[model samples]
Target: GSFWINAHIEAGKFLWQRSNKTLDSNTRLRTTGQPGDLDSPGDCLSLLVSEDDLEYYPGLPYNPHDCSDNQHYPLCERILQDTQQLLKDPLLVLEETISINIAKMENNVHLILDTIDKSISAH
Candidate 1:
């Protein structure tokens, strides 16, 4: 979710820079922009870690029934354990994805800068 959101944000920033002819060496790696800047928007992290959303998907130990039925309890418990384990570090995957996306964006920025350098040299 955060990965997609960040990707969209980065893509938007790249496009904005390209359209406005602002993709220069001075452009910094910024997730958020200063007030009045072209990319200045609201917080992205708040969208990632929403308290209200977390309340609906609370995992583990809170299961009220616990699948009391004997036949299904084993399977149910296993599922619960798996979910608990996942919940323990839910953000790990998101963090990794975000890291990868940022790396990709950095690479893209480098490529764009190199192209600009080459074009200016040719002129």
Candidate 2:
């Protein structure tokens, strides 16, 4: 889910930069609950999460529950195991269609200052 996300940037020089459209994409990679799925919104997934997750990750409210501990709470042990395994991979929650490194992306943005060298070429 949340796989496809479109982003557009306007390229300009000596004047202004703009876009007729919004900076958003229509990437499709979803997993909606269906019959016999058993992973419906208010089912296994719902029963797995905690109140903190619902508040922090409003998007993936049940994500937290998946990692919730068993033998101590009312949640199922299988759910916790699945959730723990999911977190083991640094690439969890990210749709395969949207493969990206957030740290690298942020670094690229912050490195813009280096481009100043080309701002005014010397004769």
Candidate 3:
């Protein structure tokens, strides 16, 4: 059994998987072939190509393989020297900022709605 977590975590979320694959340089993974395979195993990730796929564009695509299986671990490059440094965690900081901004925006929207309701009652 082999498992490795790359330096792509944003908070608790995996930053590599996005709704829009173009946003990241990582290879987009192929969906599994089974029907309603939600409960199936193999949630852990891997980046390996089948021997037949060696001639393809980037060669390997990310996939969720059975965690108990052993595969060659991919060498991932770390962008920051010290991930423990708060200032160095760009993804975490950005995610936190976005969350704070969204909360403020929601509060503003609620205030605006209340003001509108009061104006209508006065009218």
Candidate 4:
């Protein structure tokens, strides 16, 4: 559970970084009004270096799958899927735990009521 939660947290951080980069790029484009500025040699180099750095990270692996079907970036889509799975795991565990506790509580209640009935009958 902790592992999944940690993975979800890390994925959230990676997604935040990606969105910030996109926002920065968009802001730069809007201010410059020059598409070529976005493809400048320095910008390309920096992008490459940042991507390489991400490769060294444990979480958020880059998926090569085509994201043409979805509006989101491939990595973003994969991260969302992972997040859903991670959330489901914890919920499932909680659900099972609750059911087990409910069963135990029901048994205890039955025993208590039975004991009360016996005491009242003896009186």
Candidate 5:
């Protein structure tokens, strides 16, 4: 009965997916506020070689088949996907743990209730 955890996680993932799609669109991408300066935001994705020498900025990789049919730079899309999956995993683990604990509670339900009732009566 993880009503709170389950509902909240699903809603968050849904909202993130929708917002990410909107950001990937051309209208937004075109006016994405790219600067004409040398220190463009694009520079952030440049390869970090050996933590010292700043070498090749080879450019975004080929988009994978599963990515948004196009436009998604392979690495960026992967990072997004991985990040989404990583976020989902913890919720799944929490759900599984909740389920397991609930199952265990079933076996001890009577004993647990009795103990609670006894403690309350003594108080």
Candidate 6:
């Protein structure tokens, strides 16, 4: 389950009245999942996202997928207490993740240039 997720209905309920928690029962709303039965393999929460979803529902965060599935990568939000203790630098995380893809793109560009150079040299 996610940070605010729970098995009970009360846990899913959002407190509209910020001041009072239990007393303000009238001002409350349940943040339930999409209209469906609990038929998934596990109850863990995940965002159901796909490439096609970009055109229709861009930046919409309502979809939930299997939490345990390795195919889906989770986006983490955390306040850093100590930057030195961090295993990976938060600033370079995006760059590191796409480094391999960037290298492949560079290699492809080099190969294309080499092919063009060979064609000119042969001529």
The best candidate in terms of TM-score: 4
- Residues 39-116 of candidate 4 have per-residue lDDT tens digits of 332121111124543555334332211222232222222335566789899999999999999999999999999999
Candidate 5 segments whose C-alpha is farther than 4 A from its true place:
1-79, 111-123
Candidate 3 lDDT at 79 equals 32
Q: What is the per-residue lDDT of model 2 for residues 20-117, given as tens digits with 9 covering 90 to 100?
A: 34321121111222222322222222221445544554544222111222322432223233555777665654654255576667678767755655
Descending-TM-score candidate ranking: 4, 1, 3, 5, 6, 2
Ranking by lDDT: 3, 6, 4, 1, 5, 2
Per-residue lDDT for 1-123 in model 5, tens only?
000101001211211232332122112122122323222221212112232222222222111122222322222222345677899999999999999999888869978999999999999
Q: Write the residue-wise lDDT of candidate 6 on 1-123 in tens digits.
A: 123121111233222122224222122121233433332433333333465653455554333344344554444432222534464576478677699789999999999999999999999
Clashing residue pairs, backbone N/CA/C < 3 A, model 3: none
Residue range 1-123, candidate 3, lDDT tens digits: 222334233322234432312213232443333322321322345554555444452433544444344464544532332434656578788999999999999999999999999999999
Badly placed stretches (over 4 Å) of model 2 are 1-100, 121-123
Residues 44-122, model 1: lDDT tens digits: 2112223543454333111111122232222111223356668767688889899999999999999999999999999
Q: Give the TM-score of candidate 4.
A: 0.38
Clashing pairs in 6: 46-65, 48-63
- Candidate lDDT (C-alpha), each: 0.36, 0.31, 0.46, 0.38, 0.34, 0.41
Pairs that clash in candidate 4: none
Model 4 weakest 10-residue run by lDDT: 1-10
Runs off by more than 4 Å, candidate 4: 1-78
